[model samples]
Target: MVIAIGFEGSANKLGIGIIKDGEVLSNCRTTYITPPGAGFLPKETALHHRENVLAVLKDAINESKIDVKDIDVVCYTKGPGMGAPLATVAVVARTVAQLWNKPLLGVNHCIGHIEMGRIITGAKNPTILYVSGGNTQVIAFCRKRYRIVGETIDIAVGNCLDRFARILKLSNAPSPGYNIEQLAKKGKKCVTLPYCVKGMDVSFSGILTYMEERAATLLKEGYTEEDLCFSLQEHVFAMLVETSERALAHCNSTEMMIVGGVGCNERLQEMMEIMCQERGATLFATDERYCIDNGLMIAHAGAEMYKSGIRMKWEDCTILQRYRTDAVEATWRKD
Candidate 1:
């Protein structure tokens, strides 16, 4: 019967969600979109969250039809995100917790995604591929920790896609990645792009640099935007699939789950599904509702931690920008 409210403003999105026990009652969010050829800045994104967070919170509570006094805890993402935006959300969460006299819990952003994925997809002990604007990693639950077996050496795959989208001047209305996915569907050819995968880790900076340097030349030489987008996706996703397969083998796991913003890409999901089928494994994934960053994830993860006797004091609720996925102990899960 525990009720919890979670706040998430890790990057461009400001989300507020309410959950009762393990059931999500309301999930509300607003995004801070930048214009084409531009990425969200910390200051601007923080401003957006500050302006919209209250409205989103109000909507979440209203939609849930729950009284504020019934909430048992307040949760927020504390790390592995843009500093200003994370801090902005943390401030709001702390204020709300104090005002409501509820327990406060700080959650890791990556763990939030993983926990949410597990709850929504009902995947147990699966090797996870976590790809987002800020992170890229292949993880498995081992010894009460989300152990990272593979990761990006440089920029995340989503960042690579978003930067390339800027070079192509793609719209950021829904997202740069979504626009690229649409354009790639029309591509009939796969242009060769650098595929850099060193053992278990993948690198995207070299490929991004190569594309940036030769984009105009390639276009003039008869390659369309669709071709370039398709090629980029194929190479990067192949790298991801390769590393994920290795992680699955390393962990001796028969189930695979994809979580994070990039997990919403259909092509990536299809490729992973093929790989899972070949490996005799099950693939678990959620749509944009759980795949993209949202407050529900924070609330769910925080509630799990709280149920496991984890709590954060007022003085200990500090925001971190580089919190690793493996840093948090998954105390809530026995496996």
Candidate 2:
């Protein structure tokens, strides 16, 4: 019956959630939506987290219907994210832990997604295709660590999509990626884009660079934005699917799971499903609640760590901007 609260403001999203045992009690979040043709600045996103964290915390606690004293641990995403935003959430987590006299746990942002996805989908020892704004990796559990078998050499797939959305001046209300998916649905042509797959890893910056140049030429040549969006999605997702398939074959695992912000993409899921079906494998994914970056994941992962006697000393709680998934020891999982 371990109870925990998690604070996650790693990038643009500010999320707070409460979890008991392996079940999510409450999950609430808000994104710092930037204007069209602009990206979310770290400083501005941090400010947004600082201003809204308390309210989000309160909302989560209220919705969870739990007393402050019942919370046994306070957890926060400690790394693999924007430094300023990560620091902002860490501050709130530290303050709450001190005020409530609860233990504090620092969680890896990437591992949080993996843990949550496992809990939600009940997939044990699955090959993970983690795609997000800052990360793109094919992960498998080996000797108590999430080993990255394949990854992006340059910018992540999600970042490529977000930046391309900026080129088209798409709205960031729900998400720039979502807007791109919607536009892609309207496209009829499958314009070819650069697809770079080096061994098991996939590169997106080259695709992004070529697409940007083509967007300029195509827009002037009477090609619609929908056409460009469709081309980008098809090419990028194929790379991801191909890399994931390679990883699955190498690991000799039949189960595949997708996690992180971009894991919410239907098109990506569709492509992955088709790939998995052709190979007689299963694809595990979650809705935005578990797929997207949210406090529930941190809380869920941190609570497991806390139960395993992994607690962070107050003074030792520091932000990690480049925390790799393999850096942390997964003491919670035995298999």
Off by over 4 Å in 1: none
* Candidate 1 colliding pairs: none
In angstroms, the error of model 1 at 155 is 0.5
What root-mean-square deviation over C-alphas does model 2 reach?
Answer: 0.9
**What 10-residue stretch in candidate 1 is worst by lDDT?**
311-320
Runs in model 2 with CA error above 4 Å? none
True-vs-predicted CA distance for residue 261, candidate 1, Å: 0.3
TM-score per candidate, in order? 0.99, 0.98
Ten-residue region with minimum lDDT total, candidate 2: 307-316
